[model samples]
Target: MTVLFSNSRNAQRYRAAFFLSLPALIGLFLFHYWPIADTVRLSFTDYKVFTGEFTFTGLKNYDLALKDPLLLLSLKNTAVFFLIKVPLQMALGLMLAMLVAKPGRDSTLLRTLVLFPAVTSMVVASIVWGMMFHSDIGIVNSLLESLGLPQQGFLRDKHQALPVLAAITIWKDVGLSMIFYLAGLLAIPGEYYEAARIDGAGRWQLFRNITLPLLNRTHVFVLVTSTIAAFKIFVPVEVLTDGGPSNATRVIVHYIFHLAFRFNRFSYATALSVILAVLLIAISVFQLRITRDEDDD
Candidate 1:
């Protein structure tokens, strides 16, 4: 009779949990899963923009995308942006986290100030950064002049535009990464560091051996999310460069967006979106697999 009662109670708890999760499950299906499903279906079709008709065209869009020079360039540019943004953001974030991980008024203030840019609107950030990096009238150039240095083209220069955008985005996003790392850092047990110290472990040894390895989960999470964000870089390009003086900052999402909205190539755009989704999933899976392998090790 006691076992029967316990089983009944467990069933009731399971039922309650399912009921509580209903809203989020429904929302996930409606917002994320449904859109992705629809996009996949649309990817194989051709949309006649004026006539409002869809004709099934299997693999044609994919074939065209394979031949598209701009798409290739956008993918290359996105790879470059990811390389520039992710590593620097990760390093800077870890450093910032270490700096402000302690409990103090100064640390709290610094963390708050660091997070300010993250909460600010990206469009607004882009506009303000755009103005600051302007070739002629900007304060950056003015500062250079004051210091007897040559004024730079910055956003206008094809060579400088991509890296400049990467810098702006890193400044904006690195704060959130710091918060993640700070949480991970705080979670590390003090006793481990105490034991390491007794064993003659230096500061570098404690950080290298203890802090980093224990934060593996945090590392994977940060890396995967940062990668996705880096790949989808668009708002700054739209506001500042618009694929730039020579298509320098033409990242993947920006190109896909122009294809869909500006040029009204909905079918082709959907195909690109599907490709991007697959790419992100593949990258994420690879990252997680590596994490799993490390755990096994």
Candidate 2:
């Protein structure tokens, strides 16, 4: 009788644990893993909405994506966007976190204002920025004219469009990055700072030696995530410029969307998406490995 009861209790515990994890497991399969697997499978076939049928095209889609000039241009544009946005966002986030780490006069108000952008919807933010960047009648141009500076088209000019888009992205997203940095800062032990102070370490020396070293994980997280976000950027470009001013601001995601919906190139678009996913995964793995080595030491 005792043995039977013990076995029943163990079985009940195992079932309870499984039930507890069911929701998250379902979410992972439904939202993330399953969608990725579906996309991978779709990449090999000529799947389209109107046709309602698909035929395996093997690696033809990938070959077309590779040979396409616009795809190559989109890749270059994405690289440039990542290079400009990620560092700026990280630096701005770190600065905001440091400034708001300890409340001083008006700090609460400052924090509220800074975080407002992040809470706003991205579509709304893009629309507002679009209006602001309007060449002839926009607020930005008006201010430039008032100051007697050159009144140039922010989005209409091919050379200027990507940078303006990057700036908007940084403004809208930096608040979230700031919050992450703040959380990281809070996780750090105060004893480290106190010890450094006792050792006559200045602000710069303490930040350089302790804060940066301790925040390695946060740095890696921010870099990898921000880079991925930059690479996947689509809405702002789509809404503000429609991949134009001569496709100057066209990134890979924008191209993929156009290929799938506008050009009816479903297979090619899926192939491009798979390539992007692979690139992001490779980058994340490399970053994790490097950070793990640093942590081990």
Candidate 3:
């Protein structure tokens, strides 16, 4: 009798827990899962939000997206941004993490200072950077002129625009990567360092052998997430360059926005979005596999 009563009470507790989590589950379905499902459906149709009309177009949208020249350019630009931004961000973040890894008042202050830019609103940061990079009256140009150097167009120049935008992204987001690396660094036991030092292992040797190897998981996480962010870059391009200077900074997300809103090619935009989603998912899966293999090894 006692055992039956306990089991019944356990079942009641489980039921209560399920009920408690129901609201959040419902919210996820309504907001996230539903939108993704709808987007996939819309990608196969000629849907226009303004007209409230849609026709099933089969694979026409995908074909058109594949053939679009601007779409190809956007893809190239996104790849370039990822290649440039991720390495620089990771390197700087790792350096900052190493610098502030020790526990002290100075370290705490330095960490806070480094994290300030990451906590700032990205749109606001982009706007401030845009102003700073202005041609004639901007501070950057003024500095160059003071040094008797030729003033260069930053956002207005085709060759310099994308790289400058990538730099801004790295500056704003490096703090997040740094925090991840810091956490990884702190989690590593101090005994390892002590053991290495006793064996005459220098700082460089200790870091190269112990620190880098142990940070494998953190590196994987940062790389995958940073790659996704680079591919989804839209705000900086929109606010700073508006995909101008001969379509130099036209990233995929910005192009999707332009197609959906400006050109009213909602279906085509949805197709492009679907493709991007697939690409990110594939990259994430590949990274996960590599991480798992590393762990196994």
For each candidate, what TM-score against the reference?
0.91, 0.89, 0.93
Candidate with better TM-score, 2 vs 3: 3
Deviation of model 2 at 91, angstroms:
0.6
Worst 10 residues of 3 by lDDT: 1-10
Candidate 3's residue-wise lDDT over 239-288, tens digit each? 88899899999989999999889998888999999999998999889978
Write the residue-wise lDDT of candidate 2 on 85-142 in tens digits: 9999999999989888886767677778888988898899999998999997799999
**RMSD per prediction, one decimal?**
2.9, 2.7, 2.1
Model 1 segments more than 4 A misplaced: 1-27
Q: What's the lDDT for all of these models?
A: 0.94, 0.90, 0.92
Please name the candidate that would achieve the greatest lDDT relative to the true structure. 1
The lowest-lDDT stretch of 10 consecutive residues in candidate 2 is 103-112
Misplaced by over 4 Å in model 2 are: 1-32, 293-297
Question: Tens digits of per-residue lDDT for model 1 on 72-165?
Answer: 9999999999999999999999999999998899999999999999999999889898888899988899999999999999999999999999
> By how many angstroms RMSD does model 2 differ from the true structure?
2.7
